[model samples]
Target: MNVPVVTGETTEKHPLEDYLRFDRLPHIWCPGCGLGTVLGAFLRGLLQSGLTPDKVAVVSGIGCTGRSAGYIKLDSFHTTHGRAIAFATGLKLAKPELKVVVFSGDGDLAAIGGNHLIHAGRRNIDLTVLCVNNFNYGMTGGQFGPTTPVAARSTTSRTGNIENPFNMSALAAASGATYVARWTAAQVHQMERSITEALLKRGFSFVEVISPCPTYYGRMNRLPTGLDQMRYYRSNSVVRHGTNPNEVGVGVDGQIVTGKFIDIERPYLPSSGDGNNGG
Candidate 1:
């Protein structure tokens, strides 16, 4: 189905519009939310990857990011909370020819779906996982989550969060993901490039995207606007490809190390005869 793209400057339909479900316009994201930016990058990445939209399956769990499934004009699945990876795994196994991608938030992917995330990497599943780390549960009234930076304030952590945040890229690399990368929502080009690279990879691939939840996480942490957070990323983020993922933990108002940290070839489950199958 062809849909016309309506930009302020032009009325011509955009190439990317062919990959979006236009009926879901006026997304549920907040005014300053970065999920929209990330979604744009994803769509552009999909277009650049040269993958057929009908052959791609997007799976999303319950969260702000999970809404991606509903918006993308692909074979998509909106799964239960923290189960997007599991559902994607099934989809991939059932139809090994399909390209399975899981798009969800840090809270859902790292907090509850963490086991599936790690196991997918460990098993060398053929999948691409995009985890948007907003530092808090933006959909659920801005609660602290597994990726919340230490000493960062959230609705639950009024004073500050005491728990250490997970270095998701590091975790993915350590779990045997063949491709691992990290980028901020502000770095649209780099994010899109990384996503394209991950999509082309054969084994388990993971990309951790640091985004802003201006309404909740940002408000609680003093970055009241998305532009403020983007400025922070511009100043604090350092691109160091091949840097040790373990040393890239984000802290409260600290430096954000971003880049393609790991890219290596690994055997998929079927090739290894482990009874697993991946493209």
Candidate 2:
């Protein structure tokens, strides 16, 4: 075997660099955090969706995942806590031509903004929500939030979380989302495909990404590192593409059932007239 020595540094940029803000090269996410992976998948999906960056709007609430809006090279908005969906809804209604996406953490999307989330699905708003569920409030001292797995330890749940976590895919499907899917950060290709599909879907679409919060969530729960959590996902994930959403609920140290749980068309907003868009 002949070996060729190449010592010159390559200056070629990543294909996705064009979709990001170069000025913000160094993001604040912790080492082993999955936000970057999810963001990359979203950007790739956006490119595959055939939508121009100028006509795409990204909205995010306050959290680790919420910072996505700041890095995307689109019309991005860093909205108030638990208000990303509300803001995205208004943007979508005002400019139906624009592709509005709500990118935020589980705490921001399913807790304080729970009402807005369910209503958005109920009204079948024309928006794609990419919720990064790290299973806790990763940005706020690792407190247990609505999606924290039952019996999982958090800052608040020092011993272990008692309440059952919400099945995000199920909630989206039952609430009337036309497209609903769930994937872990490890499933990058699947995540990107789901995102692209959601973007093309006409009615409300929700994609829940199970990410690793190595800094807080993992530290408190004994995972300690992002790799540990990723390993868990790899070993425990079950991909049932057409499984019923209601049958998939995450529990502490339980099998992670992930896939496209729902895909059905529905009338959106003005057409639905459910009047549930009070957010």
Output the TM-score of candidate 1. 0.93
The reply for model 1, stretches above 4 Å from the true place, is 1-11, 270-279
Which candidate leads in lDDT?
Answer: 1
Global lDDT of model 2: 0.88
Candidate 2 wrongly placed segments (more than 4 Å):
1-9, 270-279
Per-residue lDDT tens digits of candidate 1, residues 1-279? 666556688867666788888888989999988998999999999778877767888999999999989999998899999999888888788777788899999989999999999999999998899999999998889999999988899999999999988889998999999999999998999999999999988889999999989999998988999998989999999999999899899988889999999999878853432122222
TM-score of each: 0.93, 0.93
Give the best candidate by TM-score: 1
